[model samples]
Target: MFEEHGPPIEFTAAGDTPEEQTTNLKIVRPSPGFDPASELCAEAIIKDADVTVLDFSPQQVTVRFQIDGLWHAGTPMDREMGDYMLATLKQLAGVDYRERRERQTGNFASLYLKKKQKFKLVSQGIQTGERVALYLDYKRPPLDKPEDLGMRASMGKQLRAIVNDTNMGILMSTAVPGEGYTAVWRGMLEATDRLTRDFFVMEHVGKNEPEVINVYPVEYDSAKGENPMTPMKQLMLKEPDVLAFPDIASGKLLDQIVSHSVTHEMPIFTRIPGKHCLDGLLRLVALKPDVKKLTDRMTAVISMRLIRLLCEDCKIGFQPHPQMIHQLGLPQGRVAELFKPMVYQPGMVDENDVEIEPCSNCSGIGYRGRTGLFELLMFNDELRQALVSNPRLDQLSAVAKRHGHVSMQMEGVVMIAGGRTSVEELQRVLKS
Candidate 1:
């Protein structure tokens, strides 16, 4: 009720008389059937009018708004306010959330909302020219901190990696007609990238093709040593004439590969354990120019794997193991902890009177994001010569390990112990 008017606005039956009261509440637009979906989102209720625009055209209207709601502590969505609206539109539009908005700092968020929903303003069908005043509070929500943008960008990259690296193919979560094979090659086209030679960054699988054998099936060779497929070679290498589809003796696929290598310049760097089209392509590449350099490059490619890092938003503190502290050379009185799960008793409270617990970003796993773990096997001239002479892969690995080599498992363990990741994550990624 306004001081001057001194009476509340009233609501009545659709076609009847009205009764009024002296309360502040009023029916601003009783069942008027105005759809904010077409002009703006429900979130427009709490956003800045200037930043949040409602665009109208002859065909459709667009709603653009910002998220300014505070979130619960320790959840990934805690700082992500507009997530609900974006997720809702994603479902209605039948599109992956990735397609909705531009990439924000490491996060994929729709900073400016652009959602469209259609509806009739009234049962009698009011025309577009009719003037309708929407009653609004005319208040604006506060802006988010700039750091939120960084968190978003980081999260987006990891999510993009997960979405792009699914079984279907890189960048392809679905197999739709008219969309080219989404699973492009894993190897990088850039010659300067450290992982340019890795399979995922390069070789793409062709659409509608049968599975070829794995090209690097044998355990990765870190040191040059004795050949592993000699016995099978003796059996299959008898008929050397066939190029594409030669008659292979039973139990002699390696011989066929060897024969193919010898006759057609096929590069069988290492036998891949599984069946995939990349195996055939490896053979094809072996015949190409500079095949040796390419074959040698596989060793470098297998040496690295990537892991995500923990989110700092909920990182806590606690005293680490003495051995770990000593190894890391951390100061005394320093400890490691995370946002505790709900099941346990509360720990000592910090200055803010909040309980210290395991971090929520990593779900108490101590990691929320990932980084690359490289285990290089830098073979010298002697090792290459040893490979030419044909030594076992285990023997090669042994020498590499003795000569300052690091295994992928060791890398994961180191990160876990250092609080960069969790033991569970290390196991999940390394099978340790």
Candidate 2:
């Protein structure tokens, strides 16, 4: 897949330039006549952060950025400038500028760094003032294959086989929001032969529409008393060979879709929110209340999470720690290589009494990009029989393990052993 699609594009800050690092820095503010709010927005984009939050209060406003799954404090502003910033963003999003006391939501698009970017803005009234959240939809490179999604080669091959199966079944791909679920679904769609088969997708937000795949936008109309299932019914009439629902649906509509997938021998792909494969499956069965039917038509359940990949330019190699090795159940006397981000503390001095500098490659962040940790549960006859009777999550997990299933934790350990990531990173991501 990497050979066919080339390498994944590396994400970079908008105004980032290759230059020498210097201790002297300057803070450049906008001119008196220029808009400070617009400048701040542009700066956020240049930082390449996914989400930004503005906490408004009568005294002042607090800013924060969500970068690499962690939040960092940003520059704060006075009350006057904060109010102006909120008003400017509301105007840009097409929300009612006069109605700041009520909750409102809107979206806008603009060209940033020569790329068209979209953002979702949401605001709600608070005790002291209004709180605003901004979500940036940065454009990502095309994920043309399963391996490109950070899946192990063997797991990717298994997933491809399930996707290509002729028999009718249900394959549930589970992940939290903003954790690469959509990208994985799109890659699975790309693997199918679209020319010979009909493909359809149902989603509320339409983004990154793949070629040769039909998309049906689902929206609700309160004034007209419209039903949300109308669109699903319309798409079902098309007799699609493969149907995908990016979000979980409820009520009789879900039953109809599941029934169709089984009765017509069509493979259906759906997303559920859960941390593990069995948990996702149990949730789906609870919604539909047809355990037999669901288990009978289930082909596989895949659960995944994203972890930061170690920066190759400056990652430091070390021998595995005794505690880490014992936790991973590695055999004693077997040498293993591990890598971690080199951390620098304050007030460190060299032999010449000069302060030490951070690594330029990772900017002291230790990691530069992200990869995925996946757990796949394929339903064989034994597993299906076990699930037919209601079982607890631990029991089901034990059954899967008995069948030689590799979990996300195990996958993370393997990546650590291979020097793809660090133990600290794995613990941070998997932390409750």
Candidate 2, run of 10 with poorest lDDT:
20-29
Question: Any idea what lDDT model 2 has?
Answer: 0.70
lDDT of 1 by residue, 1-432 (tens): 012321221211121122321110122222112122212323332222223332223344334332221111211112122233333233222234344223211111112223221211111113541111122233223212211212224433433343233121111111111111111111111111223222211111222222222212222121443233333354245422111211112224444444445544432232221111222223333343333333332222122334555456654445456675555434545546422112223485669999776443332333443454433234454444444443445555565567665555665555555556554454554441
The local lDDT score (0 to 100) that residue 170 gets in candidate 1 is 11
Off by over 4 Å in 1: 1-91, 94-189, 192-205, 208-301, 317-319, 324-366, 378-399, 413-424
CA-lDDT, candidates in order: 0.31, 0.70
Model 2 spans > 4 angstroms off: 1-46, 56-61, 75-125, 129-137, 202-239, 245-248, 251-258, 331-335, 343-353, 358-363
Best by lDDT: 2
Error of 1 at 214 (Å): 24
